[model samples]
Target chain A: MWLRSHRPAAALMKKSEGTRRDFLRACIAGAAVLGTGGSMELLEAAEQSSALVKSRVVIARDPMLRGAGTTVDSKRALNLLDHAMQALFDADHPADPWKNLVRPGDRVGLKVNALGGHAFSSNLQLVEAVCERLQEAGVKANDIVVWDRDTEELERAGFHISSAPNHVQCFGTDRTGYEEDLVTYGSVGSRLSKILTRSCNVLINMPLLKDHDGAGVSMALKNMYGVIHNPNKYHPNGCNPYIADVNMLPDIRTKMRLTICDATTAMYEGGPAYKPQYSWKNNALMVSRDPVALDYVGWQAIERKRAEKKLKTLEAEKRAPLYIATAADAQHRLGTNDPRRIAVIEAQAGR
Target chain B: MAREMISLADVKFPDVSPINEIARGAELGPRLLPLDRRSFLKCAVMAGAVCGISAFAEPCAALLPWAGGPTQGDSQFTAEARFYEKLQNKKIKCKLCPRECVVGDRERGYCGVRENRGGTYYTLVHSRVCAAHIDPIEKKPLFHYLPGTLAFSLATAGCNVNCKFCQNWDISQVRPEQIRADYAPPKTVAELAKQNRCPTIAYTYSEPVIFSEYLMDTADAGHEAGVRSVVVSNGYMQTESLKAAYGKMDAVKIDLKAFSESYYRDVVGGELKPVLDSLVTLRKLGKWTEIVYLVVPTLNDSDSEFRGLVRWIKTNLGVDVPVHFTQFHPQYLLKNLPLTPVPTLERAKAMADAEGLHYVYIGNVPGHPAQNTYCPKCRHLLVERVGLTTGQILIRKGSCPFCKQPIPGIWHA
Candidate 1:
């Protein structure tokens, strides 16, 4: 039941293709069992199918994304995002995915990552495309909020502050502050940003993929670190259980619907700060409903780039992103991090 | 789901002013404004007379002002920090505390207030007074030091160690810029203490060691103005730093969290040895020292640990050094734990007393007889206290009225 059919491509698959798919599914199941402390029952409960519980991740790349200057091509980036969404949902029209993601009355929050600053931040163009798509799906402009840790960082990253009633609202947690009540989960204790607790019911995580000195990767799961009041306290011991624990908070785990990583430009080393010398243009936007799978794929992408640059892998560097596997454990069960369980649909935008 | 779409303009935004706006005229760094006499008097009266520990009786509402603020600006005057040595590649190693965080350029230390910017180290919380109040020295649990007198208490955000059972985590665990603060220069703090009839200035609430420069400066100013400075701290600092800082302080109460190194490491994120060294350093410097051990049930309230703690104090610091067995209420990350039993605190006090440590007291239990200071010689109540408010003092010229046995404290007849 966990392996829900997405497209008719599965029906017309060749015999050899089916066999390869089964082999991949078995590998995924085995990995899941090992990751979850050999708890076959939890794995069965999480992914009920003997076949792979396929999580579709779309990596849509546009060669023209990096323009002559440092600015991104907004039109091309929006086109790339549209293609990614359409492919992710396997829908006939691009708008169908938007409609499926957000209902007309849903109060949507776009949690954007701007900690990487100007050089490596969530693309404002991608954010604009998301707001436009949400509006096109009959969501009110006022209901869509784009936010990060602070408004100053958002402004520094080229996001306009629109707190007006008739526009897509843009502000940070600095505006709303945090809930007075502290939420305790595992080793994590924090007051969640009121933006997540009080205002929005649906959340879309928009993190910029980058290298982290401590967490190994700043992706979807780490993006939620911004939603809490105290992130500095949770940075010890490679941010393993803290990252997984913070993501498992009821308000976050329940409301977070999708993760769209802005990977057009990423840092392979010396990040989550924006180091120009360590930066590279991947010119890709990754889309996924499973945050763990998306982060796993992002981690692989950063490792691949690091390998290309003749740099040590995150594991070799002794800062592996262990939270991804921890999130998939029996206690959390947030999502799967197994590569065989993740079907990454790579496509060139504007094809 | 039909949810009403609330406008952003409708939401009541917390104050987003930068901390520098409030911390304007502190003398440690470049002043936003010259110190004016009228402004000084006004601020002194506002900070000294009006504010009290009762001002924060409702902790939640009081913390709202510090919940959110504007991002800290790089242009804010940075006070060059002490106890740091420059390293290669624009790095610096912080030696203020035992953590010894080796910070790179544009990185902050473990405390989050000290930063390494372009190879130079600076303290962002130098003169920033995030919380201030007028409280009795007994509130600091320094019962033996200037009993029943109010001390002008203040603190800046940040702590060297992260205690899971921290009662003041809202301020201690946050960055300086995240909270709203006011600038009260050292001279201003001293003047305020003098004007408000307070005999002492207390560096309290948060770990004062993180703000050692400011604390030392304020202590010097207070000494010049005939007011003493007392510190309420976790006592997690380098030996040299401790000696230098405690040399200026009049009295110190160290929150000795636990006896075991494992407990200090796993629960408090610090080492026990440095804290012990700090106690010894204070004794060497001839600073009046007190110890408080918050007894959490089943965690740190065992017999062996209590015996070990008191034995160390009896051997190293002396039996005359006052030790308080305080009750622990579940807080911060340890909310699932139950409150420390009254019997447990009594048991700790009894054990410490049995271990030959004089002046042992039980805290957080008002109306308990152990809260009073009894003469060890005559077994007569010398000073009766209920909570932080001291009642009858039967001591004359620093001795018990009945037995004429001298009480070891700053006793003012």
Candidate 2:
């Protein structure tokens, strides 16, 4: 009863045509200098970023993207990512999508889910492509930080720990530590990652597309748990109000620029960690500004896959991602959870 | 409808490795901790130098062996947790706490340290010592338990409840992996307690309820080594788990966060009834237990709440239970709130005293008169304590020396 429909209304926007040579033309800069804020241009950037709640969530699927096992083709991965970004911002240039999402001077952070370990994790290739796109958008490679909760978890998921002064830095919150001050939002009282608070001005949320056993969905909104010091405290009650409330944190609600989910390998069940038997190569990446809508679409996709696998629906099992509706509720007002209001843009991006 | 747009694509991500390490490690049956000094240094350089654990989870100074090297597969640190039942779909219901989290495969419960691996729940924090120190037994404020003695303290990361005013939030509110920990097994813990000349080993700094397995093992180990074990906890746990876990405790100190359910639900992220039930059970078991009410300025410092708490303690656990009204300083998430007024704590003590409790004292104030344990019958100063230091002990043969009135405590350690 919680999920209103299995399929959201669809609209696949036309992809922008940007030549490979165009993307390769931009030179990678020296490592990003941490904490160098663009304080002068804040007013204009803030104004342009404070758009109303967006309801568009794009699904860029290409079956040929996944090779034998979970190995993802890096070139095709970068191509799909570029198309998805273009479609997300409705931009024409290959780099225009990233430029539209974040300013060149804005410090970018990619919060990836590393709990799944290497065999099944947010594809490192996908994150690398995002770093490449950010650099192409004129965002200094050093300015982008790719991080998760624990160093070991990040390493287990096959991420190399790096703080290279002239390259895209990847590490965990443990390296930067959490702010001493606590950020209380709804029921969550946690210390946010210093990497997010001190180093990055904007965040790029890249969550693994998986079905959480407790919360029923681990998607864009749920991925923000990595930014805070205490995510374990908010998992009770199907992570309902906590997930929505976490997104309600002003820093997350505002500084979050976009969500790019890796569905190249999605988990239908037994997740937030990978289970080989339940896993499948979904060959898709989802992009959106609206976390709630993206989650709604992701939840529906998992539900559909579960039905095909002859498994009980998440609702039947009493673990629907109710946070999607809660996020759109009056108190949160994060984005749209309504199927009617959401536009699921489906595209075979690389085709 | 807002003009929101989402883009999806199948990105064939390319070119990277070192991710396959876990697959190889898992097939090879977990990594072991290194034992030698050279191996320890090598492990640290390999683990920490790569911007791995060393740069992030700083190794504890007292660390030894350092096997798993702070990444994963510290097999010795994990033990199947008690009080959880496997359900369908690789999910398990953790009956350890009231939350009773139904965790899926490879997921964890609310405590974050215990994980459900393939339907079998394993506590990753087993023997994981993140913070260890020797503190005064009075520091645990179990004045009635063992006065004028030091207690060896240990804690693993993770607490069942999130109190806004947690003084030890750095260690209490974190996952075990998030903090740097020493690999001290039960025997090691017992040995450390003995070496430190502590009469008791205190399971503290974080909620001990979450590390029930560690506490139980350590308690047994301490007993074998001629040392007693005590636990300082939030008392928010399942009674069945409590009876089994706390049953091994020589004594317990419970931090009663609040008196009302609303305060518990809103401020402590827990329920009050379970904590109260645990207290009653402890009383029934005849295990020595002390209660500490941290009187937050506005939240739990109401007169009615104090009266209710003392009255409940009196009616349920009897007047023999020692209740300490601790001062609450602004910390964690409740910084905007003022320091819990001394008058507030005094008021709580006053109410509990008026409610016919025998042993009531004010804590966190170094030299307050109430810091001394006076005879309930003759008002003679029985045990004089200054802050965490014991100044004088006049109780003889478990009775007030001045009046010979019977005192309920282990006055002679």
Candidate 3:
């Protein structure tokens, strides 16, 4: 049989409702199909769990400093870090962003975009602070990894490599590389970073503030592009559906827990790289649990920047980050502007 | 041009003794390629023989020469690209490839490099070079062409489809802005090819079809500077654009990912028909073309399945089109299976041979006898090949010196 011909939901249903006898019988029947080590029990519970219903994305902000420049003092970085984390993982939220969302002893992978080569990238200070906080929140730092596509690019962006205990580790997929592979999203089977999907229990995205040439704006969903092996192939016709399609892949979206876009040094135009002329936006960090909304807001901010420079909007440049809509569609969410469920928290640029 | 002496002294033909005669007889087309000494050499060399045949040299080379250098010039970079039609509301639809990406005002295509700005599609990678290097023509695996020559290889970021098993994923799978790219104009790239002692310039790594304008200009420049051009591509392209592009290239390498249509749909996000169409187009155009079937273990490699593929090639592209069954190492998304076993590769070779396809070879496994060229008539080794270097040639004047059977290839002296 063709690989995709099997029903995905059937496997989950077998795990959820079946008795021990049925489980064993199904296992015998599915052994040939499921290969080795089939787990119907866990699969059933996960399928029935409300957590997978619709993942909530929170963007925490202070609301006071709506505008700021790049490079606030370390103290201000801490403030932004604190507010961002609280906004997403606050205990008071109905969804229980931390307790119910993140379990104890779950490995957290912090995927950062440092490909800008030192100019515009995720603030290492903010990421470090997030890592420290995750450790404090009962997560192990050894289980936490800060990574991107290449170690050289990460190091070039001022990320110190580490693998010791109680400290944030930094590396790219290219360093250890993807030895073992994970299933890509869609019928389009692109390989993802084994580190993010296989090694980690959950993923925390830390994308840089930049304008992508293809996807309009490189935000949370675009940040996940580094997880796959052939991200380059995803950009055929505006990289819309492909970027959306790649993010829709099981290894990326399903495991992504939190996304914090580092608008600290925003690249408003000609980006995903440092255009220099488009650099030095501000010390702004937008944190969110929902990658789609976070990136939608990021796209808004980039268009705002282009407007400030008296330049055209991303749409005028023929590069709106359409993948956000595609992602929302895949997740069965409303349009980007649907006020029924979407929430935005404005914040001060610096502490 | 200085006349150079060429010699063949140690080439060997495959041992056809073990093969069943009936299967072997079916491989040669209805009008079989001449197996005699003089005739076989002409057939072999005929693939890349159009050195000065037509006015479309640069375009032809641009379409299929396989590799080239990255370059840029001081000229104004932006030029309106083809395949886009303007519409109301400042929107446009890119009709270039099968994916007719619609863009409003200022938006790029799915490839990330091409953008529709104010209802005009512009290629961002035009005259831009992301990665450029001198590699063996064998790396492109244009076995039937000038095999041992060096090709100035070049590529820019972005692709038309998303394949999970991409080997050059770091580059081919990213946007132009995501990677580090330098400005290298067509003339500059061609000049670098000359300076680098490369006989051919290849648009490889990333899809050249997306960077059609830049490749066309570069191919023209390369030919002007006395260098050949080749294109290594997925072959998922529109007929008009592909024909126009391949007109300038000297040779073309098409990656026939799989035989199944659904495999292209589910795994590659592309249609198999376009690629197959490209093969037919290339053949009819008389472009020096070769097919590469990446034998992804458990994905595309099946003995009986690949046998059907060999049959298709024999029927469509003719028996002389060198079909390379390259081994797949676990990569990108499909890492569940191990690297294709060498025996599996051998089995595939055996299957293709059984299907009556001539010139079947296994790739990525170095030091295999299939890498060399052989005379069908006498079983004499015509060209001994190791990687990209030619060890020795036992054919003199395009004919096997020992048995005097003509070996098909571009044997110039």
Candidate 4:
């Protein structure tokens, strides 16, 4: 029963086989109906009417976008992101969703995951698309910052450091450093990154989808580990409660407005590290307002991929990412992790 | 508004400085005399340096005293670690400490310093000194060894054990890259100790075990330069590595945290048996060892535990071994607890003395009478100490002055 609770329904759907295929077909049909003229306005109206149900996720895929070598097709990736954002906010235009997420005067931070190295990192092309959309949304280029924990990892993952006041800034917490004061939350006591605390008012978590050795999967919630001074202390007991408790911090809970996970290439096993043998091409961009819901979907995607490879499920391996359930617990209530409560709108970009 | 454009080539990294620079600047005194013959001789006499100074008759000007400043950047040194075995899939098991951390590629051990990169283990804090100070040997609380003399104390940025009440948590609980440090090679450390008039180079503040490679190398250099090496540690180390490192040291002071395994697991995040084994090993090796048990109230101050600890020490390490029942102040993560009462320390000391331990003393409370050393044979006071200052040592030629009984310690004749 504990194993069943931790196993995502998507992994369970694989046993039934046709259930997920039928669900995807129904989602595609709904998106097709909404893509018609004037139906976008109806969809926006429906979004407003269903305000009571808050958990929504969008999985936008583009099969042709996977480029050879380490590079991605930037044009196709941008289109995929645009479609994901439009579906996430139920907006008529891509810029409208960005505008709703971040105001023009707000300092926006794009927290990128580069710890997985170049092969399994948040693609640079995806980051560029997000930055471009933010600028189009009327946020000044100078106020947008893309950061990770250190500059070395960012550079290794093909990111250029730019901290000039008049340009789109990119550096790391290593430059700004962590705040001197220690913030205590439950079992967690750490100094927050100044980039998250002082430099940005709005945070866009851009985590890479990968299997984690300790947390079962590194998704939107675990990606916040970069914003703390001591992540090494939280790895015990499968990173449960610690991950959920960290997400509940006021600085993270208030500032994080959206999560756009780069699922272009994911590691279904042996990960948070770049092992080519375990990687697969799952060319998609996942977007959501609820970090817990997005991570739940990402966990399912990893489980599905693992099942395809005939590998054991994370639960079978005794390393299920239980923090997803804890994040949706009564105490934290960060977001909904239940699949039944989440509406995942799946679509193909450039259809 | 028009925005100014800047090219990618023009963008530069912000100047990253070490934290130690700011801390050391406020602490270090003015520069002492240069490393000349007169200064070296004066330092030698003050340090009780009876040997090895004759070899360095000609003072090399290149070997300057520590500038008492921080080192710039994080890429100063990298040494392949000694006690690690390569495992499958580019993983390495660190055999240096009791943790035996099995680290993946590009991932560090629990200590946050030794990393496994491409199937090889490396210590990041090798020669990277984060904190350095000239402290009294009495502060290390080795009352019997070189009383009233100064020790050139230094530490790098990581520790093996995670103690909830760690006083040096800022340095011990962080990775080497997280803090600022200076590159003080083993030779540089020895030269600094000799020039600064410190008889011993103490690897302290943080756990010396995590930086055991640096400690052993510096000890070897200090031996060549006539400076003795000492360690103030938690004693959570593998037997082989512990023997290899502490074998080269003149003395060691181990913090035996408690007598219970559950307290070690819950509070210290370490094992108690390994520490007990290490203490027995130290005694067998005939090292000048001392034990300090900080009596945290309601945590490890029970009479049964104190009697057990004293009985074990008397049986295994002999009754002549010195034990300091130090007071614990609430610190770091354990700040909710009250400061350890002075009476608790006195009670623990009495229990240990009653259990047949010959040299039991109380610490941290200044001007307490138990801070002094007494002869077990004649019941006469051999050494009088207040706080960190030593006054009127009555021992002569490693023996009690009144009873003419030999004491088990490293004493200067």
Chain A TM-score of each candidate structure, as shown: 0.88, 0.84, 0.75, 0.84
Task: Give DockQ for candidates 1 onward, in order.
Answer: 0.25, 0.46, 0.18, 0.32
Error of 3 at B127 (Å): 2.1
**What is the lDDT, from 0 to 100, of the residue B352 in candidate 4?**
82
Q: Give a tens-digit lDDT track for model 1, residues B24-135.
A: 1122123112435544453343233212224312232232332244424534425899889999757789989987787766667778888887789998887687766656
Best by DockQ: 2
Question: Which is the winner by TM-score between candidate 1 and candidate 3?
Answer: 1
Name the weakest run of 10 consecutive residues (lDDT summed) in model 2 chain A: A25-34
For candidate 2, write residues A151-232 as lDDT tens digits: 8889999998889898888888888788766777777777788888888888889998898877898989899988887888
Once superposed on the true structure, which residue ranges of model 3 sit more than 4 Å away at CA?
A1-351, B1-77, B401-406
lDDT of 1 by residue, A1-351 (tens): 113222222222322355765656544554553454654554474466555458888899988786677677778888998999988887678787887778888999999987655666789889999999999999999999999989988888888998999899988988888876779888788889999998799999999889987789989999999999878777777888999999989899878878899998888987766777888888899998888888999999999999999999899989999999998787777777878888999978865
- Local error of candidate 1 at residue B67 (angstroms): 19
Worst 10 residues of 1 chain B by lDDT: B15-24
Task: Report how large a share of the reference interface contacts model 2 reproduces.
Answer: 0.80
Clashing pairs in 1: none
Off by over 4 Å in 1: A1-48, A67-69, B1-78, B85-93, B102-110, B115-121, B392-406
Off by over 4 Å in 4: A1-54, A67-70, B1-75
Q: How close is candidate 4 to the true structure, as a TM-score?
A: 0.83
